[model samples]
Target: ILIGEKRFRQQSEDPRTSPSHQPEAGITPSPSPRPRSPDDLEEGEVEEVCEICTPPSDVLVVEGQVVEPFSTDHAQRLIGQIMVLNAQIDRMQEQIDSMRYRLDSMQQEMKNMIDVLGRI
Candidate 1:
């Protein structure tokens, strides 16, 4: 997920603009350091200019296949599908509860019959 934009500020090697590198009047100037590549940038040099944008959702599936670059429409579709699945789960739970109730009733009846037979 891409949460924010990252901006990098590279340090300028120009000695004239930098006060710390200004040479003393009588001293010979020291040799300049070797140029650094983008990969060599220190941690502090990379600045994060955070513009908060909506993060992309986890991997989405379309028609039983995985899709890329999840959008708002895809999130909406996933939400709808989740709602449908929740409804189905509720119905199935109700059915299971009904079956369990029936089974318990049947078991009590069997126990009662066994007691009556034992009395005889």
Candidate 2:
């Protein structure tokens, strides 16, 4: 079933108003619910399409390799690196701005000198 269909069905039936939710209806035993693997997921579950193919395939393996969870220290180190890179970028931008101002001042002075020479 599509993800939208499952969501619609869930929304249509309000658990509070349903007879199943009522205590007098008696607890209905559910069917054997087994854990679903990545292979079991439908096309709708994975939004992204394959690079080789235009449409997404049903047999898409979302995650191939098991990755280790990131620790607090690892995240902190990444943030530190980002901060250092940002500082470098800011310094480069300031240098560029300074160079532009110097160029503009030189151009203005040259124009003033040309105007003075024209008057002679």
Candidate 3:
């Protein structure tokens, strides 16, 4: 009884264990990381960005852009393209994962079939 009560107390304290952890009735989960905004980087480029943390107010300096304000619209468009390309890469990754799963299943099935045939 003590153990059960302790477990119940711990679970209630844990936000993840509570009923609220489930989505509130009608609240749908956001879509998968697919369909990202233009600001997202391309697939492998995520690895290249420096992880250095900076203060929110820190100003970035770019030496050689033709326009003032650095033509952020161009940057957005390029980033948009990169985002779409990244989605494609993610989709391809899922495809590869699925292929691997299927390959594993097939190999297992083939082995089972071979064993059964040998028994026969």
Candidate 4:
């Protein structure tokens, strides 16, 4: 992604106006070590730049450009909802477990009563 953007920027740049053509930031130009030009970039460097710049997301087509389907706020809201739902599910599971235990205890009590009647 960075490579694509850099290439686009480089392509659009007039040869005279590129950062390579401009002086170094904060430091004076040295006669010994030359500033690295965009053209000096290796294919591997470009690939690494793309790897670094690309973010993880589900691709969505909005009009012409590829973008995220939902805004950050909407995604956060959805995440909160999901967490609430998960908590509810956990509570339901606990209730189900308690109910099952009570039912088993009741069944055992009923079996004891039946056994007592049979002996009598």
Best by TM-score: 2
How do the residues 5-111 of candidate 2 rate in per-residue lDDT, one tens digit apiece?
11112212444445433333222223333435567787667532212211121123567788789999999999999999999999999999999999999999999
TM-score of predicted structure 1: 0.44
lDDT per residue for candidate 3 within 44-111, as digits (tens), equals 44322222322222224569857566577989999999999999999999999999999999999999
* Native-to-model Cα distance after best TM-score fit, residue 43 in candidate 4, in Å: 83
TM-score-best of 3 and 4: 4
Per-residue lDDT of model 4, residues 1-120, tens digit only: 223322122222346555544433433322233334567867556323321121122123468777677888998999999999999999999999999999999999999999999999
Per lDDT, the best of the predicted structures is 1
lDDT of 2 at 84: 100
Model 3 TM-score, all chains together? 0.41
lDDT minimum window of 10 residues, candidate 4: 50-59
lDDT of 4: 0.58
lDDT: worst 10-residue window of model 3: 1-10
Q: Select the stronger candidate by TM-score from 2 and 3.
A: 2
- Which is better, 2 or 4, measured by TM-score? 2
lDDT tens digits by residue: candidate 1, 1-120: 113343322123343335543434334323334445556667557533343322122113367656588899999999999999999999999999999999999999999999999999
Clashing pairs in 1: none
Candidate 2, overall lDDT? Answer: 0.58
Prediction 3 global C-alpha lDDT: 0.56
By TM-score rank, best first, the candidates go 2, 1, 4, 3
Q: Point out where model 3 deviates above 4 Å.
A: 1-70
